[model samples]
Target: MSLVSALAIYFIIWWMVLFAILPIGVVTQEEAGEVTPGTESSAPGRPQLLKKALLTTLVAGVLFAGIYWLRVHSGLTLDDLPFKPPSAR
Candidate 1:
């Protein structure tokens, strides 16, 4: 894949992985018994966003590498999809 296409795919994978990792090891204010007066009880007491972001990057990199390897080494491509383009008819 071209650099731009690869970067775009990686960006998408990183965001998806970030969302997936966001809830891991979370501690809500309610769960920690430290809900502030003005904030929702469900709000995270310690978001640890930096740590989660780092983990997300690592996971996304590995996943992207696997997908890239599959695309290059296994000859997988959009043509393998079940549907066909109108022009192919």
Candidate 2:
């Protein structure tokens, strides 16, 4: 995999993991509308949903970067080697 391919894979994997569970970790309470667990007043009217989304994305991005590094060093990237078409064989 080249740099582009690695980046693509990382983003795909990261977002997949993030959204497979929940795009936003926030949840709505019966009266509060949207709140985190064990919290009250919903943090004084902040954008809880957006905050969760940003946090999830930030964490995913870091994880993706790590995976990209691992993939690049796993000896699977094709950058250092040349390839030939099947017909050339």
Candidate 3:
């Protein structure tokens, strides 16, 4: 692929990462647990939920960076079909 196409792909992924970290609207406690509002069960669950979300984001960033590095430097991925055909083997 051309340099422009490769850079565009990277830029698109960066935007996706940014959106994953931020959102448009707020989800109330009740909405998160799928229960009615003003309920006791949803109140204490937010901390745990936030913790999980942050951890997921951190892991995703690291994983994406690693994959990007591999693509930019090493010749791997679907774009590089290194496998030989059966006849060649």
Q: What is the C-alpha lDDT of each candidate?
A: 0.96, 0.63, 0.61
Which regions of candidate 1 deviate over 4 angstroms?
81-89
Candidate 3 differs from the real structure by a C-alpha RMSD in angstroms, to one decimal, of 7.9
Per-residue error at 38 for model 1, in Å? 1.6
Q: Residue 41, candidate 2: how far off, in angstroms?
A: 17
lDDT of 1: 0.96
Evaluated at residue 57, the lDDT of candidate 1 is 95
Q: For model 1, how does the per-residue alpha-carbon lDDT over 7-82 read when each residue is reduced to its tens digit?
A: 9999999999999999999999999999999999999999999999999999999999999999988998988878
lDDT value, candidate 2, whole model: 0.63
Model 3 error, position 55 (Å): 0.2
Give the winner by TM-score.
1
Give the alpha carbon lDDT tens digit for every residue of 1-89 in model 2. Answer: 68798668767876776675463444335345755667765454344656556666787778877766666666555565687656843
Clashes of 1: 0
lDDT tens digits by residue: candidate 3, 1-89: 56687567656665676566544244656667665556764344344446556655675667666777787678677857676666953
Worst 10 residues of 1 by lDDT: 80-89
lDDT of 3: 0.61
